[model samples]
Target chain A: MYQDWIWGLVGGGLIGIAAALYLLVNGRILGASGILGGLVDGTERAHSKERLAFLAGLVLVPVSVVPFYSSVDTHLTPNLAVVIFAGLLVGVGTRLANGCTSGHGVCGISRLAPRGMVATVFYLLGGGASLLLFKHVLGVI
Target chain B: MRALFAFIAGGTFGTGLVVSGMTDTTKVQGWLDIFGDWDPTLAFVLGGAVVPMFFAWRYTDGRLPRLGGKFPAPPEPKLDHNLVLGSLIFGLGWGLAGLCPGPAIASLSYGGFGGGVFLIAMIAGMLAAPPARRWLDAVAGSS
Candidate 1:
């Protein structure tokens, strides 16, 4: 039950299926950031209802399902400043780049898109380097 | 309609996030921490997602979406500064918090205080990004 990688694969398969369905049915890339960021930035008002529906499912399903299995613990950082700073960077960065893990990491790479591949490599490098700086050096993580 | 399909996809994605342990910040941080006691779970998750999507892309070659609109065109091949710089910044945030957009949103169901704070800050940042992006485009074009 605790075999994390196996479950990771299963769950990932589900995610892929989700993406696949979105493309096949809706004729759009199922990027979480784009779906939500469009609303946040007001660039997607034309599809706001659809976007909101997507988000509602994204938020509510987890809320509804997690209780049936077990309560989740995110183990987010206790430090308030770190949380805020990290959130800000993720928001700004994802919006500016027009993608995130869902868009660039999942959908982009699967299609072998160059932009997605490049973004993934850089972000991985950035993440690793950040860990080295903060976790290894400063012991912050 | 399109909205119904979108909702189903979102729900499935959310379920996947929960089941895959993607919502667990420690798991994400562990995956990022190469020098430390690194976790390799995220690799499986990523690879698993890509495999099906690979076929999905091929299947869409000449097919129209069942609902209405055309599929998303292939992404532009050009690599831009915004793409790289923004990704790097995003990565820094990911490494710092071990949470990206999908999981960050999903985790809100149970992420408690810290999660709430993160969401608010993220939205604020999203709001600030547009003007900054326009400024960047202007500066780049002029240079």
Candidate 2:
């Protein structure tokens, strides 16, 4: 329905605003992967407190807001092996590349940075190819 | 105060992911499944997010740093094998699972067993990346 599109736009806009806020106030890029990565990888020790606080908010806000919004249907793949493989690829890939959708796609592209643009293009191409291979060639979904 | 702002920013970002249906694996997959029953909603979400962000970038240009913190240095524009290779690997995984880091974490509360599994695996993979990167670099250098 059109409502879904509207919500998507509004929600996306909010995400941009959040990124902007982080940039304006914190003077940092609002990259989900980098923030989380720094914590787990021991690379962001100096800013651990800030990272922890941001993650706490990221998790908590969603939990609180769930009561007001309709229950979200996640539709994650049911296969455990596939899920694990996918997770590993995403985790390793994002770190190796130094960004993900939020960091590279949204934040990177907005600034018109070449690295961000290049990453985004490659990932989308990769996603597209994977979809074709899995869905059409492999027929595994 | 810094933490508070970070918290607010994170909360807002999470809400946006949830509201935009970015947390839904099917929707994400749908966008990638362009040859199949493709859903256009994700495109709208991307478009909407980019508009304000575009302006944000422009505004920050040639301005003093705000909030008493140093602005991030512009990322080095070096094009390397790792960038392309990593992105390819990431894309394949994204298409397969339809859950990236942001939605994956945000959906944890509601995503049940599958979500837990994916998160644990992701963390493990992240922990492994440093060594992997080192090994990769070693191989590249040796060759």
Candidate 3:
């Protein structure tokens, strides 16, 4: 149990450091949504191939990992309409916010931006509040 | 170098989500169900994530990344109405969908139906925003 926790922490930290470094060194903000969106949009610049490669890596890495992790079955599925609506809403929010939780919560807050700090608070709080609303209020489960 | 590393790191992170079972929307929904008898697994997952975060932030003393380039920062610093509105919408969607960009990408690794739909809708939503923003701006200006 302790080791798993440790692994999780280490893994999460590696992710955060990797993201910050990616931004600082590569000049790309490590927002998952932004990167994914860019890949679908396609690019035709000097390093566009590299951009595509990076996006490919994101998809492929998980493909590679499946052997070890063993996919767990999650029994519930929300209606397609609900899922689609949610995805669209998140898309709008990521665009409006200029980043997702990763951009603001991990990278942005690390830089000590006031906005990032505030955003992180809201991100967690909103998530928490929504959990309450979904499970308790709406009886989503 | 930064771009290359960003790609690699993001991929690895995505892989972690896939391996960790976070890509399962059911699990995400399960995690959110605190009142339906909390699962407590996600908390541990988050707790696990936070541990290294502390160390990483501590160790990296704002050194310029070995990659010469840096991501562009947003032009402004103020938390206007846009920020609040966006956060609300994001949270609302997250609550409703049980998935977000990171997890969706991770789900893509598995090549499942939900992942496909989620990814498509996510991109559409992203693409639609600029036009939506333009419309909103025009409406505000006219009024």
- Which candidate number would show the highest DockQ if scored against the true structure? 1
* CA-lDDT, candidates in order: 0.87, 0.86, 0.62
> Could you give candidate 3's per-residue lDDT for residues A1-141 as a string of tens digits?
454444445555555655645554565556676665565555325456556656767767766655654544433254677667778888877776666766666666656677766766665555556768766787653
lDDT per residue as tens, model 1, A20-89: 9888888878788788789887888887887888888888887776554466789998999999999999
| True contacts reproduced, candidate 1 | 0.85
Q: Is candidate 1 or candidate 3 better by TM-score?
A: 1
TM-score of each: 0.95, 0.95, 0.79
Candidate 3 interface RMSD after superposing interface residues: 3.3
Give one clash count per candidate, in the order shown.
0, 0, 5
Q: Rank the candidates by lDDT, best first.
A: 1, 2, 3
**TM-score of predicted model 2?**
0.95
lDDT of 3 at B111: 45
Q: What is the DockQ of each candidate?
A: 0.79, 0.78, 0.47
lDDT for predicted candidate 3 compared with the true structure: 0.62
Docking class of 1: medium
State candidate 1's TM-score: 0.95
Give one digit per residue, the lDDT tens place, for model 1 in B28-111: 888888888888888889998988899999999888989977888887798998899889988998899888888888777789
Colliding pairs, model 2: none
Candidate 2, residues A1-141: lDDT per residue as tens digits?
588799889989989999988888888898888899889989889778778888888878987875544568789989999899999989898888889889998999999888889999999888889899988899877
